[model samples]
Target chain A: MTDIQININNKTYPTATQPSIANLKLSLNSNEFICLVGPSGCGKTTLLNIIAGLDNDYDGEILVGQQHTHPKIGYIFQNPRLLPWRTVRENIELVLGEHQSPDVIDALLEVMQLTQAQQVYPERLSLGMSRRVSIIRAFAIDPEVLLMDEPFVSLDAPTARQVRELLVKLWQQRPHTVLFVTHDLREAIALADRLIFLSASPMQAVSEIIVPIARSDRGNELAIESFRQQLLQNHPEIKQLL
Target chain B: MINLKRFLSTLSLLVFLGIWQGVAVYLNSNTLPTPEAVAKVFWLGCVSGQLPFHLGVTLLRLVVSFSVAMLLGCAIGIVLGRNKKLDAFFDNWLVIFLNIPALVTIILCYVWFGLVESAAILAVVINKLPNVIVTIREGTRALDQDLLDMARCYHFGKRKTLIHVIWPQLHPFVMGATRSGLALIWKIILVVELLGRSNGMGYQLHLFFQLFDVASILAYTVAFVAVIQLIELLILKPLDKKALRWRR
Candidate 1:
């Protein structure tokens, strides 16, 4: 069965003169990692918001899973939206709820290397540390689908690389359907099973390129570079975004 | 730095007292009593237990009225701030209440309630309630919609959302309301007591006014002001520190 199905016929912002997105349709298999690449302000975040049910102002429907129930959605926003008043542990626990086991929380904290920082408040954390906490928060619920909106956009290169590697490792441990959004083609090539390219504003999928290499193999710099070259050669318009 | 701050504060108070003494000596009138005379009366009041008794009565009225105003004001403010329909409906009403003089409200309550204790307390509450509502409503309106969206995405139910997400963001506003409420309510209580009730610092002040006893009046004012300052230092300051510790 399809893990998720999204069919947004149209979405328009009241302030904008034009519809932001229309005729946007896609389906994903369970555990598939799909990266959406688009120019800035192309309604990629809007699409993600629609799928996550954070927005419902659009036309058409988004159905998750065979039963069409509201699937457990974990969203990692561009900025770590951690409550400044809450400690890192409390922020994670907020999502985990009372029923989740302490062991599960401990494991997530350990994996994120946040065990020591758990007691500290978000304001005390550096940007990278806060982002890691946000990732840990997303994973704590063991969600069926994870939606990330430019989760590493503003980080320093080294920190971004490390976080991406950590994200891949975490995903491998217990795979879930991921809809990762980024403007970075190389990052998309490295993480996604399929790269979905979106048009400029009022976005819809222009094309989709399935990465032939394995997720583990895509991490190799030379391999991803070659893939990036091939993608630019075939779809020259994508180079404009870089 | 801390020592310097303390020294400067003490120095300023001494300077103020010195000026007062100099003025009293120059005036040489019973109406403007000397600092020594006021101090003597203050000591006598403390010894006679009358000062503490009236001060306690005033403090009780302040507490009851302030609590009621804060609780109800916060609830109403949040509701109005969150709902456009309700806010529009009551926006004019809030303005009307806010503009209505505190003295008018106190007098009306006394007349309507026939000089009862509840009337005094209610008068203070009514006087203070609008300010609390205004402050909290502004806070509620300024709440981060992004955080609220995050809460909704996580499926935090109403109770969890209120406690964990909503309340923390609203803490500063609540504190703002509380501080202002304390300042405003205490003054209103004094007025209410003076106008109606035969007890509390206000009543004592009224009696002193009839006898033209400036020294006792100044003593009562000093004692009450000291207690209010003590409450601020002992209770509000510590709570403000703890609540905003994350800011550090």
Candidate 2:
């Protein structure tokens, strides 16, 4: 928490007639995996987009450390959004931006367990495989902060659970500041060091719950459920939304 | 080990030829030659070197015209596809050219440029360019915006985005243009050559028509049709397969 990496101060986004996010304030520290949990249309995705610099039409001071400019962001969308013509390997290598070595790509593919699907195009890949590739593609660029928007929403339960565990493990090793967005409370409880839950339309920071469970405690279902129960008790609004 | 489907298709073709021969026999028509009569004239023409000379001339005209059309079409299509302003500017021009009859354009080319070889080829090129441009521009417009955003976020510069993203979408469109352009331009080239030029398969057909040699005309038509089918099978199909391997 001491190594503050990114700060968003009083960010307000106007879309159509309503403000998408109003007076939003949040800061992410280095190597901390923060989960943004909220109901549908909660501006969780919108906030993540702002941090990624995808939508710049917002009133805010988004600073990387003390700098006024936005940091280089790596984004993993809900849908993989992989190039259909490019093979899985080529898709991942795309993020390398021509300066990276073949070895770097090989290592990343190996980490993501996508070595076999290297020659396969995105359309050929299953939902889980494509999502894994998408995540690795985002991570490969070595971004300052990784922004994921319900990246595992399409996967089945078991696959999602496995991926969630793998993601935390990956974070533990390489340790980039992560802002993961999802609607699943169990998922939020499992991966998040701190979880920020937002209400429905015209969303604000409704509540922030710090999960006392360590990253190592992830994948222990009983511990995870207990943590979820504790969070529900502590944050009554989040409980009511669920 | 005889494949019934293959055997039946072949039998159908033979039966159709027999029926045509029967029609020729019944009508005793000078204009509509029988299969055997056409075969004889075709063999004779080939043996006498006349067919080869005319075939070469036709091939040359097609190659020239198709090449010009491909170059012009690809350049214009890509520009119109990528640039909105250019697309808007050229929208009416494309519509006008596309609607104008090929024969009308051919006559205009003849009137404008005289009986020159370039004139005939230019006619074919102009005839095919509009359709190619429209197809490719539509494909370019249908390109996925998400992939573009992904490339932007990764800071993939112009060259990389083009090669990786834009090219994949454009490749299919280009292949489509090539197929349609080749198909259309070849036939149009033949028409222009037959009407205006002194040499080519079309010119030979015209000469045969003057002599009332129906067999020779049939032979030339069959020969040209075979050439087109061969190009489709040998070149375009294989290229299409390679280009669209990702689809599989």
**For model 1, what is the error of residue A157's alpha carbon versus the real structure, in angstroms, after optimal superposition?**
0.7
What lDDT tens digits, residue by residue, belong to model 2 across residues B75-188?
687779889899999999999999999999999999999999888888888898898888878887888888888888888888898788887788878878887777787778
List runs of model 1 lying over 4 Å from the truth: A236-242
Clashes of each: 1, 0
lDDT of 2 by residue, A54-86 (tens): 777776677666777777788989888998878
Clashing pairs in 1: A20-A202
Instruction: Give a tens-digit lDDT track for model 1, residues B215-245.
Output: 9999999998898899889999999888888
Point to the candidate with the largest lDDT: 1
Q: In model 1, what is the error at residue A220, expressed in angstroms? A: 1.4
lDDT score for residue A174 of model 2: 74
Of the candidates shown, which would achieve the greatest DockQ relative to the real structure?
Answer: 1
Docking quality (DockQ) of candidate 2: 0.68
The alpha-carbon deviation from the true structure for residue A135 of candidate 2, after best TM-score superposition, in angstroms, is 1.9
